[model samples]
Target: MSTPSKAKRKLRDGVADIASLWNSVVENHKGENPALQQRNLGMISRVLGILPHLVALMFTAYIVWIARPGSSLFSWHPTLMCLAFMVFMLEAVLLFSPISSVLRGAGYTTKRQWHWMLQACAVAAALTGFAVITTNKYMAEKQHYTSWHGLLGLIVCCAVNLSVAGGVSVMYPAIVFNMPVMLLKRLHAIFGTVVFLGGMVTMWLGLCSTWFTNNVHHDAVLALCFACPVIVLLYVMVQVGQKIFRRRAH
Candidate 1:
């Protein structure tokens, strides 16, 4: 056989071996209690749950380091926006995590309190960031919402506020007597997910901005930075989707 052919065959064999090993491991757990069967998967999920906090903190710090908040009025825009969506909003959603919430030991009421508190912080930071950017643009005599990032950001801000209002209705269903509490909760989750997705997209667009392109010179580093939020998004969606599905099943 040719050298290249041998290398290809070896790679295929390696992949097959790994797949076979994984299948065997899964088979070993067959007939076990459902929770017992999911022990390894749960461990992985717990680790994934913890990763968003670290990634958000690191990504926010990187943006702040580049933007250098307090250097000027414009500086605070990126810093505050990143903190609002990446840290506060992310944590607000994760507070309800069944397996890995930092407050998993706490009662549902406690989790609900913290969730809204973090969301309020996110809203405040987001609105303040928006105001800072508007003022910065006004002082510079620049056009507003010209770029995709700015336009989408405006929509995200509006949607976030609306979602928060929905959350209030969910929290106090008596406020909206027409809708059932269960229906209100479902609507809030759906709307909140959309807003969160918009915020992530806005962040991704910000990474593609001239400022980020110029500041982050290394291509590999920029790609890794882009992957961070995407990873968080996937984990969050999976967690949220499972809950929604389970609730529907019940």
Candidate 2:
């Protein structure tokens, strides 16, 4: 073969190898949980796990108390969406970490089952919430996908669906769905985080919506709504990055 042709062939192979990175995350799965790190992780886990639920609860309370939204079916949209995105999805992310030895086989794999189940609920609720909002918009003769909230929500919804699909796909035996295990793991981690953060952003946008702002115009409440989930999310990100991802200290 010509030198240039050989070089081109080598380049193509290198690109493919880079696309399919090694699955080092699995190697980190086995370890003794240092009493100290486990104790610290336990507290962080509690905080990370609880804050999203707190945000969802407060939002639900706001919907019920201040909004007192009439029997209109549209009232279900925010509450259900918040429950699914902020609560269930957050639980799934914080609970089902791939690289965390503390999470694996906890309770004879009860955690894995709960993780799967929570995501299933999140997907169902998100779809139903989307349908409800769309129907409400049409019933009121308002335009669809016209606002920033709608656009961002739609993108996050798609991300949620894709994340769910990827999660499911990777659950089967390797022979059943032939794909690179490492690639699937990376995709799942990256996409799951996207869905988590994107869902929060979408909810924040929802809070910023004129419809919501007009009803509960308290700046303090808005700050609360933003602060709760974000604080937890930042903690999770920083902790996960330090522990899971390859770091200089490692």
Candidate 3:
């Protein structure tokens, strides 16, 4: 029998440790498929981990197409637009790789979460900006449309933007690495505030227009804008509340 190299041995041991932890903490989430069980990360977990980005990419493409020059979208500077797109592409590469999987096994520190949040922000901003551009184009095309396609597109775009913002708040809270705990916590707190404020402003605009002008589509758009802020606020509040309660009990 051939002996395995030292590096191979270390790699095997590391993977085994991760597999053991998965079976322990994750419990029933670990699937029964033998093939998956044998893998470093289970098939389902890997897919679920990557699922968010896959959805992000699809939305990214849709928003880009709608916002691109051929459509009624905003006129963007060529250099800045290319830079933004490149940034998103870079984010995708980082998020979907084996490196991310390795990081998960290593456990996420507050610093890591902060870094992750920053990367996610770049992705979200680029995407949300695209959505806003697309909407602006639709508005420019005409005040009204005879067919429902335009209206439907607007609704979908708004929904996607809100979803992007909300999901970003969720995942971003845990992406930074290698930072001082105190600093990380402060940044986390600050980011939550920023996201909440931005979401609220977006929602307010939609609501005011809908309420005063009787804008039906604006009402739908506003729902997404409003929901993103509310959901993230509730999530952070609950997390903070739990921590406080635990501290009091301790």
Candidate 4:
């Protein structure tokens, strides 16, 4: 085996970069958000940066806990949607985190590309999960599109697909249409927000669906799993809206 120097360097670089980013956000927001500034910068940075992943983890853990041994292969539907698609999509949305000079230096366009990449992965995951559920339903002799979850999933998938198309199309307003780029971007942002909110609602519905309620006996854990992400995502969605329209409004 070769020396671990390369891996070490990458890891060291990553931590250092994150530290620099954290400090930048702290220093930039120090005067703006006094509550965060007064607290330990390290703690603030970690929470803001790491909270999304932790939320994803807890969401998946609850599903795994519910779907442990002997659960239907059908469980993969909620499992994949929650852990892979919805959570990943939320992270992509949050990538538009608070605007700051630190973020500007971090490459605004690069971050947007990352957002696109994450959403693309999420779409693929959703398609896979859709196939799993559809096949499972067929095997189980269940009727096609019988439940609220099924209906909602279909609607959400269409909305997400359309939003994604709009998102991409808006990037080239001149090529796509004669419309102004700003107008196209504003429209894309609206659809994107709608799709995100819909994703959150659909996931919550899936969690509270008969599958989870019947399987997971733990009451508090279930409640916590549902509440935390709902609250967090809603808050993030609001922040995103303000960031988007606030600029447009001005």
Candidate number achieving the greatest lDDT relative to the actual structure: 1
Give the candidate number with the greatest TM-score.
1
Cα RMSDs, all models: 4.6, 16.5, 17.4, 13.0
- Candidate 2 residue-wise lDDT, 1-250, digit = tens: 9999998899899987876554443345346467856886788766655554566567657765654445678877887787787667766666655443236557736876788898999999898889989999999999999888898888888888888778776675364366776567666777687678777777777877776787767777777766766765664565456544663355
Task: Report residue 101 deviation for candidate 1 (angstroms).
Answer: 1.1
Candidate 2: C-alpha RMSD after superposition: 16.5
In model 3, state the lDDT of residue 82. Answer: 25
Off by over 4 Å in 4: 1-49, 68-72, 99-105
| Order of quality (lDDT) | 1, 4, 2, 3
lDDT against the true structure, each candidate: 0.90, 0.71, 0.44, 0.73
TM-score, predicted candidate 2 vs. hidden true structure: 0.69
**Cα TM-score per model:** 0.84, 0.69, 0.33, 0.75
